[model samples]
Target: MLARSLEARGAEDRTDCVSFPRIELRLGKQRYWPQVLTCKLFRWPDLRHLSQLKRLCICGRCGRSPADSITVCCDPYHFSRLCEPETPPPPYSRLSPSNHWKTIDEPTEHDTARQLRRNEPSNSQNQDWPDSSALPSVTRDEHWCSVAYWEYRTRVGRLYTVCEPSVSIFCDLPRGTGFCLAHLHADGRHEMVRRTRGKIGGGILLSKEGDGVWAYNRSEHPVFASSPTLVRGHARGLTVHKVLPGYSLKVFDYQRAQALQRAMGPELPDGPFDPHSVRISFAKGWGPSYSRQFITSCPCWLEILLNNC
Candidate 1:
């Protein structure tokens, strides 16, 4: 039966439609279709039945259901298994911030004193740091309900505000998408974002659904995301997630951020820390799992600064 099926053109021959005879074989208490059994015997040894696979007509033309004169093709090459890519595990185990801090080697007292002394400025040296009081205050525009804004860092930095509920960012879109950045000037540092012209299919789509923000990956290459709300319960170390093409992930949760803010209290840390900010890299990932330690090391990336979250 296997030899005859192999020799038979099946659907490969464009002129005529060849159909394999329906045969059922029983082994112990199990019954199997001849076509499915043949497929498992030669091509996919692990494939169970037609339910786990999709059949494609090799002749390049066939409808979902054939007419009375047309026959179904049973060629093993015409079938493909349906499956999704597995997500990689986080870099660190379930260790809280305090516990994770304890794992690191503490600095020596002398080293700490030396570092403090090095940071301290001398009276004779003129301070290069800009005075906070001298800078003008920025106020938000009341015209639109701004949820978030993207900060792009290329040869020169540019900011694009998101006033609408949903927005699409792309390099080159023929239809003139939500926020087209193709005409924007860039240098060698922004080459990765510029390469999405004709090579990659589409760009990312961000939508404000309910209290959370969702990011849909429509591009050919995967997008990497790192958000405070997404890594709430995890360790202090950065956690970067790889979002595959045609997949959507909830990048930010407003309720979770509020709860986290309440737990943290009014006292803020001396170091720069923004609980509502999110970072996404295009076509590249950075974190403990990857060679790049920080998102700044990525070629093309977006910094999403959220408001009133």
Candidate 2:
């Protein structure tokens, strides 16, 4: 049997319908080995030898971008830091079924008051912030919020919220445990795509008091907190603001309740210097390009969206 086969691949399949091949990546060290594999294969030619070992070099791996692999979950998604020049968004007819562009619920004075009362002083481990579990249930708590998933307009001025139901539900989660994030696919499904370990992991906790949320700098490095907010007036969309790490930020105050600490995790282990490969292979293309896959585990909000509430 043929171990693997090649098919027509590009940004799209041979027929050009979305084709997201499941990158059957068994982590051999690099963090996002799968998606990074796809990028190295289909996207670019910028990967040095894994750990700069000249014996197992690129001549054995370079330009070998495979097309077909394990059956995929859905179509591939292209994430660009650069927002595409505004284009017309999909009309209502072509839009996904779960999308709704609703304004985020802002905390009223009364709600904030209630949250403060519910979070009355106690023998909490962190005195500055109350325990997340002490607050009332989701239906009753003002601070019970989830990360809202939105599909923003690429060409037009609009954002469609597909899934925002269950991210921040921490009832079953362990107090100190951390979970990872997934990409909220356009089809109302989620696929794991980001990192969730090291200094920071998966998501943060929102304390009911002050409509407040606390982020931990679990990583040794500094992380910038980022939240997606609605632009004032007719803009009818979201913009992100970066908040520094080791602090608390107001939730419900932004379009999305969660934020991401923008740091690319601990550095990849610098392998023993192999002079032959260090001078040629590692120097040839993208040098040590692991951190670029994602800044944090699951990009925060999207990570929560993919969770079981």
Candidate 3:
């Protein structure tokens, strides 16, 4: 209501402004979408003092922005100008009543089923997978069980959910190679020796020439045992899963592992050893069992691995 607003501002001398109450429109008991267009006048010749008046309102149909509209009255002719474009409803679909007026009859259930069948797969056998029991069990002495088992934290595979049902597991060897369970166990000891700089908490080194020892206070063994899931194989290649409670574990493809080794090159020892066979070991359970094992042992092993790498 520009007129009312002007009057309220003591500027009745300007042009007229009025808005009627909201009007509702319905079509066949259903309300159709509406679009509103409003215009505003920034200043009027006679209402120069009330130029600062700012009143913005929307229309019943579409909520158009007429906030900065300005109305102008030049002599006998009146003109209204709005800056924003008026958005209208999208065009009707080509299959509307106008195009298919006689097709309102519902299709029979048989007809619908026929159409669905026509587009369905020809054989159910094409989509069915062999049962898990039929699938080969992951070998216990697989090489991937070594490093891949430790890196299982970052493996790519289906996330298990009780509410949802699915089946997925990996059992193939990695591209280059993977460490076996025995190798992983033996290497874990090497990791401990390298990490503690030949002084694993209780001061024991694997070798006089080697840095630290894995059997420092008997804490590292449990840690290594807890991370024995690498024995599980993937149909494709090795896949690791992060099961540690607090620590975020990740599995790595060969490329990622190499990249990580390169990134850590600065910290690596000058040995000819490659980190490819070394995998991370995580403790089991949320209690002190997993934490104490990993915390005490991993650093020792990590230090060992770093030195050998």
lDDT of each: 0.47, 0.23, 0.21
Instruction: For candidate 3, write residues 46-85 as lDDT tens digits.
Output: 2221121212111111122333233221211111111111
lDDT of 1: 0.47
Give the worst 10-residue stretch by lDDT in candidate 3: 121-130
Per-candidate TM-scores read: 0.51, 0.24, 0.17
Give the better candidate number (2 or 3) by TM-score. Answer: 2
Model 2 steric clash pairs: 86-155, 87-154, 87-155, 87-156, 88-155, 195-297, 196-297, 199-218, 199-219, 225-243
Q: lDDT score, residue 213, model 3? A: 11
lDDT of 3 at 150: 21
Task: For candidate 2, give the lDDT.
Answer: 0.23
Q: Candidate 3 has what TM-score?
A: 0.17
Which regions of candidate 2 deviate over 4 angstroms?
Answer: 1-175, 178-203, 210-218, 221-236, 254-309
Give me the runs in candidate 1 sitting further than 4 Å from their true place.
1-157, 188-201, 232-234, 267-270
lDDT of 3: 0.21
- Residue 264 in model 3: lDDT: 51
Model 3 RMSD in angstroms = 32.6
